[model samples]
Target chain A: MIKVQNLRKVFRVHKKPPGLSASLKSLFRRDWIEKVAVEGADFTVEEGEIVGLIGANGAGKTTLVKMLSGIIHPSAGEARVLGYNPWEKHDAFRRQISLIMGQKAQLWWDLPGADCFQLLREIYQIPQQQFDHQLNRLTQLLNVGEELNIQIRRLSLGERMKMELIAALLHSPRVVYLDEPTIGLDITTQKAVRDFLLSYRKEESPAMILTSHYMEDIERLCERIIIIREGELIYDGSLRKVIEQYAPYKRLTLHLQNQTLDESSKEIFSKMGEKVQIQSDQVSIQVPRKNVTEVAAELLRKFKIHDLSIDEPEISDTIEILMGGKDLRQE
Target chain B: MFVNLAVQLVVLWALWTAVFAESGKELVGEWDLTGILSYGVMVFLTGRVVRGGDLQMAVASEIYDGSLSRYLLYPLNYGVTKYAQQLGNVFPNILQSIVMAACILPFMGSSSSVDLHVTGLLMCMPSLILAHLLFYIMGLLPQLVAFWADNVWSLSVLMRFITMLLGGATIPLSLFPEWSQGALAILPFRYLFEFPTLVILGKVSVNDWLTGLLTCAVWCVVMSLLVIPVWRRGNLRYTGVGI
Candidate 1:
C-alpha cells in the first residue's frame, strides 16, 4: 500500500552565465534558483492496484517516484510505502519495495545477469528455494532463458531491460514504482513487457505506480490514471471518467453518395458541430457527446449516406489540451 | 601486469642508484647501502600491493555517473560494498608481491641475507590491514567532493603527490632530518608505508610495533568517523543524473 500526503521536493540549482569571466566569477559568487520538481502531490494506491501517472516532461513524475522509493528525500510532506517512510530507508521497508527507471540500469555491465541475480540474492537474503522458484518463473514468463548467462552489455536493449526487470523483482517487492518501463523497446518487446506486467499483477497483486509517455500503455495497463501538470495534480480518476470530464465530444465521419457541394447542408453540419473535413464523397464533423446518435440518425435520414462512423476523442489530444490549461476544471 | 611491475622496479632502482652515487653517501643514518636497497624494494612491492587495485575511483565515479542511485535503493551500505571490492582486489596482489619479492631479493646485492622476519610479519598483519583501510578512506574522502564540484581528478592527482612525499613511499622516513621525522611521526602518512615496511623487516622493537598498531587504530577510527558526515552530505547533494 502507498499513501502520500502533500509530498513535495524542491531543488536549489546554481545558475551560471556564459563567457569565461562569468564562469570565473561563479567560482566565488554564484546565482541560485529553486526548482520545484514536485509540488504538494497527494495520492493513494491500494493493494493489487496499478495506477498510471501521466505528465509532460519536467512535470515531477520521476521526482515523485524517486521520493516514494527513497532515492531522495522529500522537501515537505510525507509518503509511506508498505507502512514505512521511504525516506528513512529502513531495511525492512527497502526489502518490500522496488524502483525501476527505464533510462537507468541496475545490472552490472561486465558480469552476467545471473551473477547480478546472485548478488541480489545475497543482499536481500532470499532463501535459495524461493530464489530459484522466483527466478525460474520470471525467466520462463519473460522467455529470457539463454540470455541470462550473457554479459549485460553484450545483450540488446530490450534484453537488458528484461534483465533489469528480473533483477528488480527478484526480491518479490510488495510495492513497485515503474518509470517508463517500456521505453525504447520495439513493439514486440513492448507487448511482451506489457503482458508480463499484467500477468505479474495477477500473480503478485502488488501495488504499482507506472509512468510512461506512451498512451497505449496507460490505456491498456492502467484502470485509474492521475494527470500532473506544472507540478500539480490536475486530474485523478478512471480513464473513461477522464474522457467524459475533459473531452465531451465525438467525431462523425460520413460518406456521401449523391449529396454534392451544397452550402445549406454545410451549414446544417456546422450547426451540429465543427466541420472537420469535407471531400467529394466523404464528410467528417464533430458532435457533442450527447448528440452523437441523434445527429447520425438525422444525417442518415436526410442525406444519401453511403457509410457512417463515430469515434471518441483520443486520450492523447485530451491530455495535451489539459496540460495546455485550455480544458482544466476550475478549482 | 608483470612487465609493468618489472619496469617500475627498474626505474626506481635506477633513480635511487643515481641519487646515492651523486650524493657520495654509503649509509643513511643507521641503514647501509644494502639496507636502503632492501628498503626501496620493500616500499616498491608494498606500495604496488596497496595502491594497484582499481576501486580507487569508485566513489567519485558512482557520484558522477549516477550509479549511486542503485546502491541507495538497496539496504546495503555503499562504503562497505566498495571496501569489499577493493579488498577482493588486494589479496591477489599481496600474494603476487610476495612472489616478486622472493624472486628479486637475490639480485638486490643482499644475497638472501635480509631476514624474512616471519614472526614480525605476523605481528604486522593487523597494522597492515589497518593501514590498508586508512589509505582506502583517505583516498575516498577527497573523491566525495565530486558531489559538489564538477571535477575532482586534480584532488586525486594531488593526493598521489602528498602520499609520495609524506607516506614514505619513495624514501624511508629515517633518511629525513630528525626534526622532520619527529613531525612526520605525528602524521598518518608514515604508517601507510614506513611502519608496515619496518614491521616486515623486523627493524622495530615489540614496544614500537605495539605503539604503531595503536596509532593505526586511532587513525582508522578518526578517518572512519570523518567519512560519515562527508558521505551524508554527498548523498544529499546527489541528483542521480545520467543514470
Candidate 2:
C-alpha cells in the first residue's frame, strides 16, 4: 500500500540567457529560480490496485514516483510506501519495492542481462529457488529467455525493456512503481509488455503505480486513474467516471440516403452540440449525454436517414477535455 | 593506450635523464644517475599499477549524468561498490608490472644503489593496499565537488599533478629540501609512493616502519571519515532531477 499527502518537489534551477556575452556575465552573477515539478499530490493506493498517473510533460509524474521510491527527497509534505518513509531509504523498505524507469536503464550495459539479474539477486538477498522460479516464469511470459544471455547493448530497445522488467521483478517485490514502462516500444511489443504486467499482477497482486502518456496503456490495465496537470492533481476516479464527467457528449454518426447535406441540414446539425465530420453521404455530430434521445428524434424527423449509430466518448477524448481545463470533479 | 603510455614514458625519461645528465649527480643528492633512473622506472611502474585519476572521473561522470541513481535505488553502499570495481582494475596492472620488472630489473644492477629488501618488500604489501585506499579517497573527494560544479575534469587533472609532485612520483622525495620532505611526510601523498618505495628499499628502521604504518592508517581513517559528510551534503543537493 502507498499513501502520499501533500507531496511536493521543487527544483532550484539556474537561469542563463543566450549569447556569449550573457554567458560571460553569468559566470560572475547567475540567477536562480524555484520550479515546482510536483505540487501537493495526495492519494492512497491499496494492495493489488493498479493506478494510472496521466499528465502532460512536466506534470510531475516522474517527480512523484522518485519521491515515493526514495531516489530524491520531497521539498514538502510526507509520503509512505508500506508504512515506511521512502526518502529514509531503510534497507527493509528498499527490499520490498522496485522502480522501473523507461528512459534510464538499470541493467549493466557492458555485462549480459543475466549478469545484472545475478547482481540483483545478491543485492536483494533472494532465495535462489525463488529467484530461479520467478526468473523462469517472467522470462517465459515476456518470451525473452534467449535475449537475456546476450549483452544488453546488443538487444533492440524493446528487447532490452523486456529484460529490464524481468530484472525489476525477479525479486518479486511487493510494490512496483513503473514510469512509462512501454515507452519507445513497437505496438506489438507494447501490447506484450502490457500483457506481461497484467499477468504478473494477477499472480503477485503487487501494488503498482504506472505513469504513462499512452491512453491505451491506461484503459487496458488501470481501473483507478489519477490525472495531473501543471503539477496539480485534477481528477481521481474510475475510468468510466472520467468519461461520464469530463466527456458529457456521445458521438452520433448518420448515413444519409443517396443525398449530401445541404446548407439547411448543416445549420440544423450544428445546433446539436458540435459537428465532428461531414461527408457526401455521411455526417457525424456530437450530442450531449442528457439530450441524446430528444436530438435523435429531431434528426430522424428532419433527415432521410439510411442508418445511424451512437458511440460513447473515447477515453482519449475525455483525457483531452480533462487536460483542457474542464471542471471535471466527481467526488 | 600503449602509445600514450610510451610517449609519457619517453618524456619522463628525458626529463629526469636531462636533470641528472646536466647537473652531473648534484641535482640528485645521495643518488647517482643509476639511482635517479631506478627511481624514475619505479615511479612510472607505480603509476601504471596504482592510478586513481580515472577512478575519480568515472565517479564524477556517473554522479553528473544521474547514473548514480542505480546505486541509490539499491541497498548497496555506493562507495564500497565503486571501490571494489576500481580494485578489479588493479590486478591486470599488477600483472603488467610483474612482466616488465622481470625484463628490466636485472639490467639496473647495484649501480642504482637501490636495495630490493625481501623482508621490507613483504612488509610493504599491506602499506601498498592502504595507499590504494588513500588515493581512492583522494580521487573521490574532488569528485564530490560535482554537486556544485558541472565538470570536475580540470580539478581531477590538477589533483593528479599535485599528487605526482608531492607524492614523489615525478621526483624522488630525497631531491626536495629536507624541510619540504618533512612537511610532505605530514601529508598523505608521500605515503602513496615515496614511503612505500622507501619501505621496499629497507631505508626505514623498524621503529620508523611502525610509525609510517600508523601514519598511513590515520590518513586512511581521516579521508574515509571525510567522505561521509561530503557524500551526505552532496546527496542533499543531488535532486536526481534529470532524465
Candidate 3:
C-alpha cells in the first residue's frame, strides 16, 4: 500500500565558523550548505508485509519514514501511501497511517495514558464502540491495562512505549512506520514488544516498515529487508537471500582429544578452510558452506574429534563488512 | 499568586497616583485621578487574562525539538490544536482575573468615571476574545520561523513590549493625541487592550464597539490567513530532529 520513486529531501543549513571573530564575521556574510538527508530512495511495501529497514546511525532511515508519514515534505520525487501523496497530507491518508518514534513520547506527560488515548479518539473521531474494543484488545495484548491510569511520566520507559503503541494503533492505521520501537528496552520487554507487534501484524495486516539497529529484531520480524547506507538504498531483498548472498561461509568449532598443535596439521587445516585457529585440544575455522561437512568429517576421521559445531556467521557482522565496502561474496 | 497580584496592584496605584499629584491637575485627558486608578485595576487584571504564560517559548521550543512531528501526523488542524493549548494555559488565569477584578472593583467603583454595565461587558467579551486570538496569532507567527531559524525567543519578547505600549496596557489609550488615536484605533494592537478597556468603561457608542469588533475580526482573519503560508513554508524546512 506504499509506493515511493526516487524520493529525496534536501535541507539548506547555514554554516557558521567558530571563534569570536569568525562568529561576528559570519553575521555579515554567512555560508550555506545543502544536505541530502534522503537521496533517491526507491522501495515499495505491500499489505500484510513487514519490511525491515536496516542501517547504522545517521543513515536517513528516520528521514525516509518522516517523508512517507507526511511529517516533512520531500525536496523532490514522489511518494504515494495508500493512494494519496503523503506530502499533500490529506486527512484521509493521515487517518490511515501511523508513525511511532521510540525516542519520542507522543502522549501527554502529565495526563494518564488512557486520557491521551481518549484525546486521540476525538482527534481521529473513531467510533465509540471501535475505540473501546481496540483499547481493550491492545491493552490486553501489551499487558499494560493497570498502567493506563498512571501518568505517563510516572511509568517506566517500557510501559510508556507500550502506551505509545496503543495510541498509534487505536485508529487501526493501514500503514505503520516503527522507528526503533524496541530501543532502550530490556531484553524481556523487547521480546514482549516484538511478540506483540507480530500478533498485531497478523491481525491487522498493515504494511509495516521497521527501522532498528538491533539485528535480532530484524531477524525475527522481517522476511524482506532493505539496507540503507549514507542516505542511499544499498540492498533490498528477502532477508534470507541477502544473508545467503553476502555470507556464503559457515564457521566450524571442533574439540578433539588427540588433536596436536603441530605445524604439519595446522597446514592441513589451513588448506581446508580460512582463518584457522588451532589449540591444544580445540580448533575453529571458517569453511565454505558446501565444504563444512566434508571438512568436519575429515577432521573427525583424522583426529579422534570429541565435538563439532557448524554455524552461520552473525548477519550483523556480514552487514558491517558490506557497509565497509568489502566483498562478501567469495565467487 | 494572589499576594503577588495584590502587591503589583498596590505598586501600580502608587505610580499612577504620584503622576497625577506631580502634574498638579485634577484631570488629564479623559481620565481623572480616579479614572486612571480604575485603568490601573483593569490593566492589572487584564494583563494576566491576556499574557497567561510564555506562549512564544512553548511554540518555539516544541518546533526546535521536533515535538511537532507527532501532531503533524494526526488528522487534525495543528493551528487550532495549538490555539486550544494556548487557551488552556490561560483559562485558569481567566478565573483568577475575574475574582481579582471583583475584589478591586469595590474600591475603584465609587468614582463617576468607573462605569460597569452588563451591556458594555457583554459587548466587550467578543472584542476581548478576538483580541486574544489576534495576539495569539501574532506570537505564533514569529515562532513558526523556528522551523528555519535557530532561535525566535527574542521576537516574542519584542512583541510583549510593543503590545504593552501600543495596546495601552500600562497607560490609557485616551491619553494619546487625537491624530494618533484615529490611526491607533484601526491598528490591531489597540483592540487587544485599549478597545476592550473602553468597552468595559462604557465610554464607546454602539457604532464604535461594532466598528472596533469588525476591525479586530478583520485583522484576525488577515493574520490567520498569513499563518497558512508561513506555516506551510516552514513545515517543509522542518527536519524533525531529536526525535
Residue pairs clashing, model 1? none
TM-score of each model, paired residue for residue: 0.94, 0.95, 0.95
Pairs with backbone N, CA or C atoms under 3 Å apart (clashes), candidate 2: none
After superposition, candidate 1 runs with Cα above 4 Å error? A258-272, A288-302, A327-331, B111-115
Error of 1 at A303 (Å): 2.4
Residue-wise lDDT of candidate 2 within A1-331, one digit each (tens)? 8999998888889899899999999899999998888889999999999999998878888888888888888889989899999988888888989999898888998889889899899999999999999888998999998888899999999999999999889888889999999999999999999999999999999999999989999999999999988788999899888887668789999898997667887888888868568978888999988998898888899889999998898899889878877765544
Error of 2 at B230 (Å): 1.6
Per-prediction DockQ, in order? 0.55, 0.59, 0.69
Q: List the residue pairs that clash in candidate 3.
A: none
Winning model by TM-score = 2
Per-residue lDDT, model 1, residue A275, is: 49
Model 2 alpha-carbon drift over 4 Å, by segment = A327-331, B1-18, B24-27
In candidate 3, stretches whose alpha carbon ends up further than 4 angstroms from where it belongs are A267-272, A278-280, A288-302, A306-309, A326-331, B177-179
How would the candidate models be sorted by DockQ, starting from the highest? Answer: 3, 2, 1
Q: If the candidates were sorted by their TM-score against the true structure, best first, what order would they fall in?
A: 2, 3, 1
List native contact recovery per candidate, as a fraction of 1. Answer: 0.47, 0.40, 0.70
- Comparing 1 and 2 by DockQ, which wins? 2
